[model samples]
Target chain A: MRYLKLIKVFIKTSAQETLMYRANFWVSLLHAFLNLIVAVLALVILFGQTENLNGWNLSSTLSLLGVYLIVSAIRNLFIGPSLEALVGLGQEVWNGQFDFTLLRPVNTQFLITFRIWRLFSLIDLFLGGAVLLYSIFQTPQSPNLLAWLLFLLALVAGILILYAILLAFTALVFWNPGYLFTWVFDAIFQLARYPLGIYPVGVRIFLTWIIPVGVITTIPAQVISGQTGAPIVFLILAASVFLFLFASWLFNKGIKQYHSASS
Target chain B: MNHRGGFALIKATWFSWMQYRSFFFVLAFGWMIPPLVALFVWSAAAGEGSLGGFTRGEFITYYLVLVLVNQITYAQVNWTVGDIIREGTLNHWLLKPLSAIYQALSSELAGKVVYLIFVIPVGLLLAILLKPEIQTTPINFVLSLVATLFAWGLRFAWGFWLAILAFWITRADSFLALQDSLVFIFSGMVAPIPLLQGSLQQIANILPFRYMVGFPVEILVYDLSNKAILFGFLMQLTWLAIAVLLSRTLWVKGIRHYSAVGG
Candidate 1:
């Protein structure tokens, strides 16, 4: 309840900043729209030359694209922006500004994550929904309510894994406090856009185990489209649970290791 | 100003880039992976048959060459220019004896050189593993290099002008992001021009984006007629001229606006 109140205050403070730069919202929206168009065009050209990709047709691929877009939009909307601020705590530590943050009454993680917000990033969520619906329309097998529930379940699991993976990356900053380590993570996430089946076996292993984007994107699509069994979704849910706990523990440990600039 | 000065700036830039060699190595891999993923996808889609005149091996060759072309021509000038304007660091460049364009060019050339150090080794490994079909003549190789130089020039200038928009607008980086979307769409990053249907193909033919990266890759991978290669060069030159004009105009106007209001 306290955290909720804190976040409400944070949002109210951020709303003014977001409103001042209204052009940014439109620009970001256009950018997202254009990126989706390119992605669709790529699929169109691929399907033009051949009907199916490893037994996946245009509609199936479009659905996969939709999941990628929506998942990323959700990340940008809250998870990504919030955790990015957590990563910036390393800079604060280096500059001796972290002591002030740490002295706050609230949880350090909560304060770190909720300090700033970019409401403009939410534009991607709408566009992602549109693309998802467009693909759902194109698909011959329309998902039932139960299927959507399953898809949403898998999506939550996928999103949790993404957040966990990204959180672990940010934790490294507390130890290093110099290089922008998040950029290395940035290099890998774009790979999440494609289905893992397209990659070779070795890469498939890496994406599944290390980054986990393969599971994050593919399992959701596979479940939603009825391409795979329900058992797979259960497996992913279990893995996501484990990853979330592991990442949180790692982040706390890293925070403990942080020696402030003043010290 | 002089040969020694220019060479010294290039040398300094190259050595500075070497400081982040490890980062560039990872980043080069990141840049290379998307094209490789596309190759795998297209090759899988092709299966036993050709798609849009690209056999599986041909698709492999096209994407592999594209990896090289895209890396060389990729300009991060917009980010730099945006930073310079936003931070009011243009004063430093204005005080310098050399033009800002030369500084941008120096950094760009150094980045390419540093990036290629990793990219060439990776390219060789990919070539050996994938065993791409190459239809390169000595003449075509030389012409491709010339075309690539023009392509880089055109891209660099295009980004430089876009960056100058930061002087007029609060968030010019969004425009660059938008331009990146168009470049991805029309520059044949997503698909070959032949694969682009109807109006899209015509847009690619006329747009500056295609010449920035794709035209050179097409020359490298495809057996084009002499007339076709010549026409591509003409288009590249035309775009270069326009980009140059745009950059010069923007730089002059942006400087006047900055000076008038900066105080």
Candidate 2:
């Protein structure tokens, strides 16, 4: 019940903070829309060059790009801002701000997780949906009910995995207060821009097992394109759950090391 | 021509970076990731062959050179300008004997010098390992040097003008972000402009984005015809002149409405 109240407070604070900057809100929305347009132009250029690139047709590639953009957008909406905030939190903790957070009758991890949200990032969600729908309309092959269900399932799992990864990276601040790991995390995600098939087998293996960026977008794309089976879906789900649990454990361990500036 | 004050300021900025050497390294490493990833992807696509008339070695050389050129030409003036406007820091600059732009330009140059230690060695190492197809002609080298200087001036002026837009809008970061996204697409960060489709390629050529990085990098890596090289240099100078005139006009006008907001 306390956790529910904490979430409510976080949402309220975030909304209020966003409302404070009306100009910023509109500017960020326009920025996101421009990014979406650029992505569309890129797709058009890619298809214009050839009907198929490396055996992936225009529609399939567009579907993959759509999934990539949506996953990336969702990550930016939630995890991205949180990660940046975590860096600031790391600095603040080093300078004794953790004491303030600890004094509150709220879970520290939960407080840190949802402290800030760039509400304007919802533009990416709308843009991604539009692109996906446009691509589906143009495609001859239609995904059935099962495909849709599995794709949504994989997507949720992917989001969980991404959240876990971000949490784990944030928790690293306990050990290395410098917040240098953010760059590494960003670089790992950059690999997801292309379909996993374009990468070598070794890279694909590393991304799947080590970084799990592949699950963030590729698995969902595969499901939507009807390329994967139940086993792969099960694997992704299992990994997502494992990662979340592991990251939670790490966060708890890190919290114990927190030394309040007040003391 | 009493320039001692300006020289001292530039010297102080350079020395400050020396005191914080690790920060420069961290920033250069952060900046290198995107271009490095692009190099790998393009290399993989070329795959012991050629794509769009660019061999693997040529692509590697092009991007390696691009990294250095981009570092040298990058202007953070917009960010600084926006900060000054938002934080009321511009009042200090306005009171100083030197123009605000001189301070911004000096700091940017100092940053470039600091970044060189990290960038140059890595660039040379990559060039040696990858063996990028570069034309080693005296005239080409001279032209590259000239193009880089012009590019720096053009980018700095352009960024300064964009920063001046903060006088009109509080949220200028969004516009800067949009400029960066355009740079990534049109400045040959993803791929060569020539490799893009007919209309996209034309658009890239018509814009100053290509002159900012691609033109110099291309001149270094490939044997451009005399006509093309001449036209490219002319275009760079033309853009630089336009940007300088616009920035000068905007700065004069922006200061009139500059009601410093916060500190």
Give the winner by DockQ.
1
lDDT of each: 0.82, 0.79
Question: Ten residues in a row with the worst lDDT in model 1 chain A?
Answer: A85-94
CAPRI band for model 2: acceptable
For model 1, the DockQ equals 0.61
For each of the candidates, the C-alpha root-mean-square deviation to the true structure, in angstroms, is 2.4, 2.7
The sequence of per-residue lDDT tens digits that candidate 2 reaches over residues A1-263 is: 87777667766787798898887767777877777776666656545544555556677767777887788788777577765664643466566776676677766777777666667778888888787777777767788888888888998999899889988887877776665666766767777766776665767898888888876888887788777877888888998999999999998898787665544
Which candidate should be chosen as best, given TM-score against the real structure?
1
**Which 10-residue span in candidate 2 chain A carries the lowest summed lDDT?**
A45-54
Clashing residue pairs in candidate 2 (N, C-alpha, C atoms within 3 angstroms): none
In Å, residue A257's CA in model 2 sits off its true spot by 1.0
Q: Second chain only: TM-score per model?
A: 0.94, 0.96
Whole-structure CA lDDT of model 2: 0.79
Colliding residue pairs in candidate 1: none
Interface RMSD of each: 2.1, 2.8
